[model samples]
Target: MSSSPATRRMSASQRIIVDITDWNRFLFAGKPISGVHRITLGLLRAWKKLGLPFEIIRHDPETNRHKIISHRFIEEDFSEPIHIGGGRIEYSYNKYVQRRTRYFTELAKAKLRRFVKKKEVVHEDFIEGNYEPQADDLLYFCGAGWDAPETMHAAHKWKAQHPGFRFVVLVHDFIPLINKVYRNRLGTRQFRRWFRDAARSADEFICISDNTQADFMLHWRRCGGQGVPRCRVVTNPHEFLSVSDTRNQPMSNGELSAETFLANRNRRYLLTVGTLSSHKNLERLLSAWNTLNFFRDPEADLVIVGDNDPRDVRSLSPIRRNVFLFQKPPDDILKLLYMNAFCSIFPSLYEGWGLPVGESLWFGKVCLCSKSSSIPEVGQDMCPYFDPYSTEEILLALTNALFEKDYIPSYEKRIDRGRMKSWATYGSEIHTALLKMT
Candidate 1:
């Protein structure tokens, strides 16, 4: 599913119209970007770098209109590097400033366009012109659309208005449906509605992993979806590994760098990145860690990152002093922790596509993750796997990863960085798939 530069571009008349409605919402929410958001941003950058003819649009819920976002505006405002490092106050201040800047920038552009009445658009969020999809145009939604029901409604409307144009939805995972008990009740309901609507509206499906594709097909069929749309699997890439380069940045006042923090502790650490959600299997991981008696080991420490909810910390408070949890660490700090870790553990019971597994492999670290779902597809032979549900298996893997002298180095030697999937290849595969359907 690879494509050369020449084959990646569509014809002059046809274009890939990416729906960034959710992307805008993510930015506006001022919350830490999730894996889905990162994927959306990465794909946009990849497509832009490939010189593909594309336009970005956001659905306006108030008016039920799709606003064409200026490519220049996106490039200038968002395409900058993302590094949300610092303490709580600094992070909040930065996010607030960013939001206000973007808000004013878009508002000013809109006002300036009205005053000048120029034909050439500079930077407008809501463009004056209406966009009618051409027969060959591909309308793609590559972001998390379940959060925005308006996007799904727009997709349905677009499919009805322009029957000839192709509409596609990128399926990240069916976790919300599969692991409903582990998710928010209202969110899961919305996910079902979104998936059903997408299945009915889309002419093609782009799944992030093989397992996700199978789940999507199974659910689609069970839901009594209409005529089958061509489905394809275009796996997520490991470009995030490159974000570990934070050597040149100045250290924040009174804050120790991740490297210094680790050095000060003077201990080896096993790292895990994810929320405290039950599906992540953190409770199981903690059980194994405690059973192993590493909680009392001064030479070893278990550092948990990405659990922002304070209520979830109550369960973990029982752990001994050696266990550490850094809630919502910055990307740079997280990458640094990965770089200096003894190993990484992902005890997720299920996953759509395991980002932590891919990330660990990218860093050439020993990753002990679950055997279930799409994780193995990312880890392959570079890491050891075990049943996430089995504490014994997890403990065994942990013991081997920690005690076995050559266990990690052996796997690390096999890490072929060059063979790893990249965002460019990901974009090319999606483009090729769309071309095939056309």
Candidate 2:
């Protein structure tokens, strides 16, 4: 029997079109890319592995044109996009600048050469006006596809001219549409307009979580979107392990002191891993953590590991001496943190899918997960659920996690199941869906 529904092998005859506009934007603005970027990249790599006939395309933001450009993704294991660092290189200390000088110089030369060779075609990737999309062609917008609405608008006209041109969109979440407080006024308004247009234009839909699909259909009907395409709920494939699997390794990283290290030896740390934002409800966790009677559970510390908003940290009720924020930990350190942590906590009030909750289970650690949105779908019975809105609820969960040795009653099944959710499986599911369109 096949391990997954997506396990069927794909043939090379499949002529699928993919939107890759977001990839270039991510490259230039490279400051720790989002999960969307990672998912898109993983999907592309998976499709290529299947050797299914496909065209990689993107719409030119400047020219409003589109074309298939497959050559851009030949390299793999992309090195960290050179960080320019916080301070300007010109005024920086010599030692610091010298360390990254080679990267900066190469980047400068590359940009200079592009500028020097400027042509009428600022972008060479634009689709020629004469190049019309073929009938029976499938356009898959797997990313947010910021220009999806615009493409759908133009696609309607193109479909009238040509035939059998269909577009499939992947809706990650309805956070912006459903919750105004989640985003700023301008961003929320922009997303609403864009989503409304996308809803009207897209021929079909796929949602990462059930919450997203239900909300999308609700909005589509509410907004009276056209030709409401069939929506599929294909859960995301999570290969959360680093290429270098560091399981079973000792956690003796020298970042912590002898005192903190000794303290951590008794019960290990409580972890929360994800980019901190307003929606994550970390402030409440911090508030609850502060109020916890450390006299009873003094050994445990709360270790937050991810890129986070400084403002959120600053606004924390009171910075606990035991609570440490480890911003942007590398893959190795992160593995250790996950492996050795006593239990993971996710107080996120909203998410397309709570990756940390699954990751915690994947590492065989207990999770104090929220009962909000699609989080429960990821956690199931594997994690201890808590109301993210209530500090008391969070505090109680924390206490249980710290005091109760058997907080996660049974999670062995979850750990085993999470391993089958691979990117190959994800790619296979996506290909199967594409074939259905044909």
lDDT of each: 0.70, 0.65
Q: How many clashes does the backbone of model 1 have? A: 0
> In model 1, which residue pairs have backbone atoms overlapping below 3 Å?
none
Give lDDT tens digits, candidate 2, residues 166-274. 7788888877665633865555565666676667666788898898888887888656687646889888764563422222433322365323454456556788976
**What would you estimate as the lDDT of candidate 1?**
0.70
Candidate 1 local lDDT, 78-179, one digit each (tens): 323322211111111111123458746755655565467545322233353445667677888888876655566666776677666788889988887876
Q: Which residue segments of model 1 deviate by more than 4 Å?
A: 1-9, 72-130, 179-183, 241-260, 294-298
Best candidate according to lDDT: 1
